[model samples]
Target chain A: MTLTPTPDAAASVLAWHDVSVSIGRTAILDRLTLAVPAGGLLTLVGPSGCGKTTLLSIAAGLLKPGAGRVETRARRIALMFQDSRLLPWRRARDNAAFGLRCQGMPRRQRLDAAQRLLESLGLAPEDGDKFPHQLSGGMRQRVALARALAIEPDLLLLDEPFNALDSVLRRDLQDLVRQTVTARGVAAVFVTHDLTEAIRVCDRLVVMAGPPGRVAFSTGFAQPADARDDAAVLAGLQALWREPAVAEALGATPGRRRVTA
Target chain B: MTMATTAWIGRVTAAFLWRGWAVLVSLCLLAALWQVGHEVYGGLVLPSPMDTLRALGALVAEGVALPAALETARDALMGFGLAAVAGVLIGAAAGLSVTVGRLLEPLVRFFLGVPAIAWVVLALIWFAGSGLAAVFTVVVTTLPVVIIGAMQGARTLDGEVLDMARAFRAPLGVRIVDIYVPHILSYVFPALATAMGLSWKLAVMAEVLGGTAGIGEGLSLARVNIDTADAMAWILLALIMLLSLEGLVMDPLRRRLEPWRATRGQAARERRS
Candidate 1:
C-alpha cells in the first residue's frame, strides 16, 4: 500500500517506496512506505524498538534497505542525532561548520557562515570559541542544528535530537527547529517517542509499531504548529490516544476502557 | 596589553618561577644526600656532588662532554623518530581492522616480551661495532610502546561520532584527518613520551655495550679506569639532557596539540562560575 502524505509527487522532497530492513534473523522494517513533501515537518512517533530510528537512518542514506527503494529530490541531506555528537576537540563554530568543511569549503567562509547560524540560534559570538564540553546542553544542540543547516540541506533528518534536554529546553529547541524548517523551506523527518511533542511540532504525524515495524496510523494536523497552545497540544494528545491503533503503537492503554463487571 | 592578557602572563611567570624554585630545593636535597654518601663511602666508590660537578666542568672545558652528549642525542632521537612514525602507522592500520589487530597483537606482545638487553645483544651482533647497533636497540625497545598507544587510540574512537561523520557524508580523507588522527594522537602521545624516555636509556645501554663514542662510552671508560667522579658526571649530563628535552620540548608540544585537554579544568571552572 502506498502512503503518500502529500498528493503531489513532484512537490515531495523525499519518498520511501516499500522500504524494508532486517538485521540477521529479525525484521526491523516491513515494506514501509512514507513520504515528506517539500517544506513539511513530519514526525514519526513510536514505541522503543519500533524502527523509527532505522527509518530515519534510511532517510539519511546511512543504511541500505533490505528490500525496496528510497528516492529523494533533495540536493543535500543532513541528519541530527539524539546526542549533540559534536567533536569535543572542536570549538562550537568549527563543529557547526563541520559539514561545510567536509564539502571542501574554505575555513574562513565556513566559519563566517557558522558564526551567522550560531547567532541566529541564540549564541553569543564568544560561544563559538568554546569547545563542545564547555557549552550547555541546549547550546550544544543549537550547534548541532547549525551544523545540519551549514550545508544548506534541502532535507533534514532528526533522531530525537532534544531527548536529553529538560522539558523547557526541549520545547525551546522544538520551536527553534520548527521555526528554522519553516524559514528555510526544508523538508524534515523528526523521529521521537514523545506524543505531546510530536503533536506540537508536526504538520503530519506517523505512528509506527512492531518488530517488523510498519506505520500503524498517520494523520495531518489542521492547526499550524506555531499556533498550537498547551491546551491545544493536550487536546490533540487526548484525541490521539482515543485511536486504538495509535494507542497500541505507542504502548499506551486505550483512552476508553470498556469496564464490564 | 589587555587586563586579561596581563593576568595570564603574570600567572604563567609565577608558575614557572614556582616550579624552578621547587626543582632547586629538590636538587639541593639530592646534593646533600650525595655528600653524606661520599663521606661514608669515600672517593673510591661514590664521588661527592661537588666533585662530580667539578669533573663535569673539566670534561666541558676539555670539549669532550658536548660532542659525546650530542652523539647520544642524535642516535636516540633518530631511533625515536623512526619508531614513532612506523609504530603509529602500523598500529592504526591494525586497529582499524579486527583481523589485522588480532594478527599483530601476538607479534607486539612477543616483541615486548623480548627484553631491551636482549635487543641490544642482538643489535650488537647484527650491526657489529657501528652506531647502528645503539639505534637499532632503541627502536626495537621503543616501537612496542608507541604501537600499543596508537592501537588503543584508534580502537576506542567514538562510534557515534563516526556515524555522525557518515551522516554528513564526510570523505575518507576528512574522516582520517579530522576524526581518526586527532583521536589516535591522544593515545599515541603518552606512548610516545614513554617510548622517548625508554629510547634514551636503551641507546645508552647499547652504546656502553658496543663501545660507541657517546656518554655511555665515556661511562664505560670511567668504569674501566675506576674514576667514580667521571662516571657520576656522565650520568648527571644524561639526566640533565633528558630533563631539558622533556621540559622545553615535549610538554609544550603536547599542550599545543591538545589545547582542549590542557584547558579542561579551566573549562569546568568557567562553567561552574
Candidate 2:
C-alpha cells in the first residue's frame, strides 16, 4: 500500500516514538521519544557517551532503531557531516554541485548554481575551481555546507560540522546556516558538543545523557532567536546550564571514535 | 621552458639515474653468474654468455624470431586483456554480494592452487593444438589473481565514503562508477602488472607444451636439435617482450589513470607502518 503525505503533515518536521538502538550488547538510545515542529531549529546536546549522534543518525535514516518508528514530513532532507567528505578527484565547485548532480540536474545549470552558491559562501572563483586537497580545511567545510544548502532541503541534519573550525569560522557558519535554513523555513536538527553554539542556534535545546541514552530534558529561551546577541539570551543560556544533564552534557569529552547511547 | 619545469625534469632524471644504476649493477651480477656457470659446466651444458648473445643476434637475423615473438606477444596481450575485463566484472559482482564473495573465495583459491600445467593439459585436450589452448591457459591462471585483487580492493572501500555517497542520494550507477571504480583502481593497476608478466610466462609454457608456432615452440624445436644457445635466445626474446609490455604500456597507463594514488604517498606510507 502506498501512503502519500499531504501538506498537513507539516505539523512536525520529525518525530521519534519509543525509538531504541543498540550496537552489540551496549544500548545507544532506549525508548527515546521526541518531536520537532516544521521550521524549527532543534539542537541535541549531550555527554560524549550519550546518543546524540545516534539519535541524529536515526533521524537522518542512516541507521534504524532496534525498536520503534521514526516519522518525518520533510519532503527533502540533507545531512552535513563533520568532515567535508568531498570526492578527492572532483573540484570544489563540482563537489558543491554533488547533491544536484545526484538528482540528475544538467551539468551546466548545476555548475552555474554551485558557482553562485560558492561565491555567496565567500569562496572566490579560483577557490571553487580548486580540489578538496588544495583547499583549506575551513574552505572545504564551507563547500560541504554549501553542498547541503544547495539542495535547498526542507530539513537539514548537522553533526558537529564546525567542530574543527576556529571560533570565527564556527560563528560565521552558525550564522549562515541559521539564516539559510531559518529564512527558508527549513527545519534543522543539529547535534553538537558546543553548548553555547547549540544555545545560540537552536530554537529548542534537547539534552541526552546516560549509559542507555535518553532525552534527559528539553527547554527554550523566553527571548526570540534574533535577540540571541542580547545579554538576556546569554543569561537564559547560563541558567539552562545549571541543569544537571545540561552541565554533564557540556562537560563530556565525547568518544573520539563514536558516541555510545 | 620555465625554471619549475627544468627543476621537475632534473628531479625525474635524478630518480631515473638512481634506479637505472641499480638495474645496471644487477644485470652485471647476473652476467657474472652466467659466466661462472659456463666455467663450471662447460659450453655444452651451460653455454658461454657471449655464445648466447651471438645466438640471440643470429636468431634475430634469421627472421624466425620476430614472427614467433609477435605471435606469443599477441596471445599474452589477448589473455591479459580478457582476464582484466572478466576479473573486474566478476569481482565487482562478488564484492557487492557477501554470499557471492564467500562462494567465489573457495573457487578462486582452488584455481590459484592448481598449477598452470594442469590447466594446459585440460586446455590441450579441449582445444587440441590451437592457439586458443595457449591463450586459455594464460587467462585461467592470471584471471584468479586479478579477481582476488579487485575483490580485495572493493571490500576495503571506506564505509564512511560509501555512507557519504548514499546520504547525498547518489544514484546506484553514480555510486558504483564514482566511488567503487576509483577505489578499486588502486588495487587493480598493481595487479595488472603482475598479471601481464604471469600471462606471458604461462602463455609461453602452454605453447611449448602444446607445440604452437611461438617462442615456446621455437624453444622446443631448439631442445630437440640440442641447440642450447637457440633455446636461450628464445628465452631472451620472451623476457624482452614481458619487460617492454610492463614498462612501456602498463606503467604509463597507471601513471595517467591513477593520479589520486600517486598524490597520496604520505597516506600510503602511514598505512604501510
Candidate 3:
C-alpha cells in the first residue's frame, strides 16, 4: 500500500489512496482514489453493481481493501445503512445513544445527548421512550439518524439511508441529513443510486462504474445544497446526464429520453 | 416515589391480582372435577379434594411434609442450576462454530432420546441409594433441553444487527452483554421453563425409585401402606410447589429480563384500556 501524498491531505477528512478490493476472482473496487474535504457532503452515484456500499464499508473501516490504504484524520466515524438497524430490545433513546454507549460515555450524559439529537431531528421527546417496533418507519429512521449524529463523529458514511421511505419522507430526511452534516461541520460520504437524490443534497458528486469500480466523472455544485430546489436539482440532473462519461457510466441512453427528478 | 411510579406499581399489582384470580378459578374447577371423580369412584379409588387437603394438613402437622419438600427442592434446584449454567456455556460455544455444533448435535440428541426413567434406573445402579441419584437423573434428563434452547438462540442471532454493532465499534464485552446474551435468552427462556418443570418431575421419580427421603419416597411409603389419601396429598404438594415456582419465580424472572418482549402488544392494549 502506497500513500500518494496530496497538497490538501491536511484539509481532507478522509482519503482513499488507490484503494482496490477483490472477493475471490471478482474485483469489487479497482484502484479507486477519492477524498472527502472537511465538512463536505460527497455523494457517490452509480448503477447497482458498481460497489457503492463496498466503498462506504471501506470508508467506515469495516472492510480492508485488498491493496492500498484508507487514511482518515477523523477520530470517530459513523455509518448509517439503508435499514435503521436499531436494536429492537432498546428504546429509541437507548438506540440513539448506542454509539456513545460503545464509546463508554456515562449513561446519563449519552442518553441526554441522544434525547437532544432525536428532538433536533424532529422526533418528539416522548418518542424516545418508545421501542423501534412502536415507532413509524419515518420516525425509526429519524432515530437512526440521531444515533449516527449522537456520536459527534468527524466523518459520516451513509448507504442509501432514506431509500426505504416514501419520496416525501425521503426528501425530508435528505434535507435533515444535509442540514445536520453542514451544521456539525462533519465530512460525509453518501452512497445512493438515485442521481436526483444525489444532486439534491451533495456539495460534490462522483459517478462510479464497473465490477472493478472506478470514478467516471466528478463535479462540484457551486450552489449550496440548501439553495437547491426541485427545479435546480432537475436542471443539475439533466446537465449531469448530458455528460458522456456519466451517462455511459450510469448505463443510461444519452439524448434518447428526458431525465426526470 | 413519584405519583407516576406509584400509579405504575398500582397498575402492575392490579394485573398480577387479576391473573392470580384466574388461576384460582381454574384450581377450583380442578377441585370440583376431583370431587365428582371421588363421588363416582368411591374412597379406595379417588379421594375428595377436601380429604386430600386434610391428609396434606395431617402430614404437615406430623412434620413429615416440609422436610421432604425441602429435600426434593434442594436436589432438583441443584441439578437445574448446574444444567442451566453448563448448557448455556457449552451450547453457546457450539452455536458459535459450525464444527463444534455438528460434533455436539448427535450427542445431545442421543442424550435427549434416552427416557428419564432409563436415566433413573441407571442412576439407581450407579448411585446405589445416595441422594446424588436423584440429582443425576434430573440433570441428565433436563440438560438436553436447555442446551438446544441456547444453541438455537445463538445460531439464529440477526447478522444485520451484529454488523451494525461491528460498524459502531462496540467492544467485545458490550457485544456479548447487549447483543448475544439478550438475543440468546429469548430462545433459551422457553427451554429453561420446560427444563425447570421436567427437573421437578424427574427428581421426584428418581427419589421414588432410589428410595431417597423426599416427596417421591413419601409417595412410595403411602403406596406400600395402601393409604390413597396420603399418596394423593404428596402428589398435590408436588403440583402446588411446581406451580408456585413457575408463577412466582420463573415467569416473573422471564418478564423482568425480557421486558421488551413482554410489553410488545400489551403496551398498546394497556394504552387503549
Candidate 4:
C-alpha cells in the first residue's frame, strides 16, 4: 500500500531535502532529496562505498547533513545495524527490552512487552531467555528486530540488516519486516548493496552512485506482490540496467547479465 | 540433584581438574627450584620452603605478625579503594575530553616513570609518618595503571552501540550508567587487577620506610636483627595474601561482572552458584 503523505512537510514520517554531508575534508553525500511516507519501505541500493549508509544515518538523524534539511514527524525512531548489536550481557528478552529499559519503563512491563514481541516474530520462550552468543545468526537477527519493534517506532532505519544472513533466514526476515511495516505502519529506509534484496523487501527501490552519493534512479516495485519471484525480479532488472547511470552504478553494461547476491 | 545438575557439577569438576594440572605442575617446578636454592645457599641465606612456613607459624605463635598483616591489609584496601574511585572518575573525564586527556597524559607519564621509592620518600615527608603516608604511596604507584585502563576503555567504546542507544532516545543517565560504564569496565578490570597487586606491595614498602607497624615495618625490624628466616616468612605471608586476594575476591568479582566470557555452558552454573 502506497501512502503518499500530505503536501504539508509535517505530514511525512521522514523527509530529507537537498542534504549534503562531508567527513574529514572528504565529501560523502551530495544534495540528496528523499522521503519515506508513513508505513512505507524505501530501500536505497548501490555499490559499496556509495554513501548509502551516510544517507541513511542522515535520515536517522545520527549525522547532520552539511547542506539541506532533514525532517521527521516521529516521536519514536529505531535504527538496526547490520550486526545484531545486542548487548552481550543481556539475554534475548532483555536485549529486546533494552530500548524500553533506557526509556525508564518498569522491568516487568518492558520484559513482558518484549517477550510478546519476540513471540510475534517467531521466537520461542526458551530462545528469548538465551544470551545473544547462544543464539544462531538468524535468531539474533530476530531478536534485534524485536528490539527495534519493541519501541513501536514511527520511523525505522535499517542498515543492510539482512546482508549477514543466509538465504532462508534473509527471505523470512524480509517477509517479517514487510509484514511489520504493514501491521505497524512504520516508515523505514533500508540501505543495501543487494539489488534483488532491495526489490524483494522494499515498496520502492533507489539506485545511488557516488563520489558524494546521490540518487541516480528511483522507481516503484512494479510487479504485483505474488509475481515478485526471483525470475521476475531478475527479468525486470535487465531493463533497469539499460539506463546509463544505473548501468554505471551497477558496474554492468546494458547487454551484460548479472545476479547480485 | 537432577541429572542435568549432576552432569553440570561433574563438568565443572573436570574443568577444574584440567586447569589444576597446569597449576600443580608449575608449583612442583617452583618448589624444586626453591629446594635447590636452599641446598646451595644453606640456611643463612635461603631457607627451605618448609622452614619458611615454620618461621611463619612461629611469628603467628608469638603474636608478632598477625597484627602487622592486618595493618598492611587495611592500608592496601584503603589505598586501593581510593585509587579505584579517583582513577575511574579522572580517567573517564580524560577519556571523554580530548583536551583533558592531552593535558593529563604528560603528567600520567611523569608519575608513571618515577620509581615507587621516590614517591614513598616524598609521601613520608608530606604526611610525617602517618598511615596516610603509606596509603599515599600505594595510591601514587597504583592510580596511573587503572587510569590508563579507564582511558582506553572510554576511547574504544563501540560507536554503533552508542548510536543505537541514541536512536532509542536513551536518557543521559541510562547511557552513562548502562552503556558507558559497562563498556568502560572492559578495559578497567585488567588494570584494576594490576592495581590490586601493586597496592599490597607498595603499602608494605611504604610502611617499611616510614611507619612503625604493618608487614613492611616488621620486615625492617627483622632486617635489623638479621633474622632472614622471619623476613622470608613475612615475604611468604605477603605472597599468600596477594594470592588469596586475587583468588577469593578479584576473580569472583570479574566472573560476576562478565559471566558471558566464561565457559558458555557453565556460565549459568557459575552465576547460580
* Clashes (N, CA, C under 3 Å) per candidate: 0, 1, 0, 0
TM-score per prediction, in order, is 0.93, 0.77, 0.93, 0.86
Residue-level lDDT of model 4, residues B140-183, one tens digit each, is: 89899989999998988888888888777788997887779888
Q: For all the predictions, what are the DockQ values?
A: 0.62, 0.30, 0.54, 0.49
Runs in model 2 deviating more than 4 A are A1-12, A15-33, A37-40, A63-73, A88-92, A115-140, A162-186, A210-213, A221-237, A248-261, B1-57, B121-128, B224-229, B262-273
iRMS per model, in Å, is 1.3, 3.5, 1.9, 2.7
CA-based DockQ, model 3: 0.54
Q: After superposition, how far is residue B23 of candidate 4 from its true place, in Å?
A: 5.0
Q: How far is candidate 3 from the true structure (C-alpha RMSD, Å)?
A: 3.9
Q: Which ten residues in a row have the lowest lDDT in candidate 3 chain B?
A: B262-271
Please provide, for model 1 over B1-273, each residue's C-alpha lDDT reduced to its tens digit, 9 standing for 90 to 100.
Answer: 999999999999998999899999999998899899999999889988989999999999999999999999998999999999999999998888999999999999999999899998899899996669989998888898899999999899999999999999899998888899889999999999999899888888988999988999999999999999999999999999998999999999998888766366686778678
lDDT of each: 0.89, 0.83, 0.89, 0.84
lDDT ranking, high to low: 1, 3, 4, 2
Task: Report the C-alpha lDDT of model 2 over B34-73, residue by residue, as the tens digit.
Answer: 9999999988888988999999899889898899998998
Docking class of 4: acceptable
Which pairs clash in the backbone of model 3? none
Q: Which structure is stronger by lDDT: 2 or 3?
A: 3
lDDT of 3 by residue, A1-261 (tens): 111122333588888999989999999999988878888798999988788999888888788899999988999999999999998889999999999999999999999999998999999889999888778789999998889888888899999999889999999999998898778888899999999899888888888988689988888876778888988887888788767888889887744556632
Name the regions of candidate 3 deviating beyond 4 angstroms: A1-10, A254-261, B1-3, B262-264, B267-273
